[model samples]
Target: MEVDYSDIRVIGFDADDTLWVNETYFREAEEKFAELLEGYETKNKIDQELFKMEIKNLALYGYGIKGFMLSMIESALELSNNEVSQATLSEILNLGKEMISHPVELLDGVEVVLKQLKGKYRLIVLTKGDLLDQERKLERSGLSAYFHHVEVLSDKKEKNYQDLLSHLNIDVKEFLMIGNSLRSDVLPLVNIGARAVHVPFHTTWQHEEIEEPKQKTGYITTNSLANILEYL
Candidate 1:
């Protein structure tokens, strides 16, 4: 089915993996986290426990490096039966700090796509994460000039998208979103009667992964961030 972008006036982009490196850092942190707890359990078990801890604490901590750090600390305590050394806990914190301080790396063609669409369309960033961290990354990305507004949402559910679009005075018919995660960035928009384009990242956080529905969704899928230009 052919999707139309001629009706799209405001384009929202997902920040993390769609514009720059994000999930890769989390994956790396998990690997190091597994190694830190290797004495207590197997790597696979450590990975599973940490993921569980993260989900269990999602409501309490929301999302971002701080929440992830806390989850790692909790997972370490449980995995080690509270015998995990204080030094080990500190090291886990360092892993998150390193991630927080990690430099932003723009994905290929991000600039070209944003630049071409900046003036022609109303560009905005509608990503979900810790506000401070997302702001820091956006400042580092040097792409802020392109977006008219940036929102750091707590979650990307259908209601969230509806409220944001309403608040922004953007009509659903004129709104389009593009991102790397189908679950967060694409599906919600589609569910809310807006258009979305999916550009898969090389690595996606397991939490963000979702199986495609058997029924057809109007959302379009493109191979790369640049590929969506063909649709736009």
Candidate 2:
């Protein structure tokens, strides 16, 4: 229960999986799409190919409907060998958009923890995704009141972490980032001397996986979102 509150003015959080059940919905959709292509490709191959399309699209359109739509199109095209009908691609795009349009659901105990810390800390959301999509999710989650600011960026690199703190007029040491995804959330923040807590989700997106463990930062890992409240 020894959480550090010393000079920690701003607490940054990664939105997906941390605050709400995001990846599950996306995963479910991907699996459904994979089933559609089962006749053309093996499940693992479809997943691997779809993963590559997503990563490539992330660079082009960043996170959100735009990137996801492109991935759907690319995956469908790739699976069909450029012979897929426009009708099929249109259906896939529609499905993807429908998935994104769904309401956001806050994770277990997210409300309890946010209520506990809202008054004491400058809570900010620093999530990487489609700007409008992320914002819409935040608005629907009904937890936006607890956050002072919400940042939707293309990526969560070390530079993004450093730049955000600088723009916020806060020192790196005065911040603490809490969320899932070691690759996006923990490592970059820790590199700048900002403390971080890693709440590992059971199924992270392939692009978001950490290739190696970051053992040096002393970053705390929690099994559940509720467990985070005890630390804070």
Candidate 3:
């Protein structure tokens, strides 16, 4: 089905993975974390347990590297029967710091697309993560000036997008969202009567994976960020 975008007045972009490299860093950190806890359990088991701990603590710690670090620590303790060494715990903290301090790496054509769409429509960032960390990344990305506004949401459910659109005084029919996660960035908006474009990144978190139906509508998918320019 051909979707229409002639009515879109505001475009929302998901920051992580969509504009810059994010989940890749998390994958690297998880590998290191698994290595650190290898003595307690197999790498496979450690990975599984760490994922479980992250999901379990989502409500308490929320998202981003800090929460991931806490989950790793808790998983280490549980895996080790509360016998994990203090040194290992300290290393986990260091891993989080390293990730937090890592420079933001923007994907190809991110600025180009933003520049092309800047004055043509209202451009805003709609993403979820640690507020400080996301802000730091935006500062480093050198793309902040292109955005009219930036929002760090707690979660990206349908209601969250609806509330954000309402807060921005944007009508549902006049909004478009672009990002990599179908779960967070695409489906929710589609369900809320807004438009979305999916730009797949090479790597994604397990939590973001979804089953694409044989027949679906309400959104479009592109292979790269550059492709989104065609629709706009």
Q: How much lDDT does each candidate structure score?
A: 0.93, 0.82, 0.93
**Residue ranges of candidate 3 with Cα displaced over 4 Å:** none
lDDT of 3 by residue, 1-232 (tens): 9888988999999999999999999999999999998888999999999999999999998889899989998998999999999999999999999999999999999998988998999999999999999999999999999999999999999999889888889999999999999999999998889999999999989988998756667799899899888887
TM-score for each candidate, following the candidate numbering: 0.98, 0.92, 0.98
Per-residue lDDT of candidate 2, residues 135-215 (tens digit): 888889988899999888778999988888899888888798988998888888877788888888777887787665634
How many clashes in candidate 1?
Answer: 0
Task: Please report the TM-score between candidate 2 and the true structure.
Answer: 0.92
TM-score of 3: 0.98
The stretch of ten residues in a row with the least summed lDDT in candidate 3 is 211-220
Worst 10 residues of 1 by lDDT: 212-221
49-97: candidate 1 lDDT, tens digit per residue: 9999999999999988999999999999999999999899999999999
Q: RMSD to the native, candidate 3?
A: 0.7
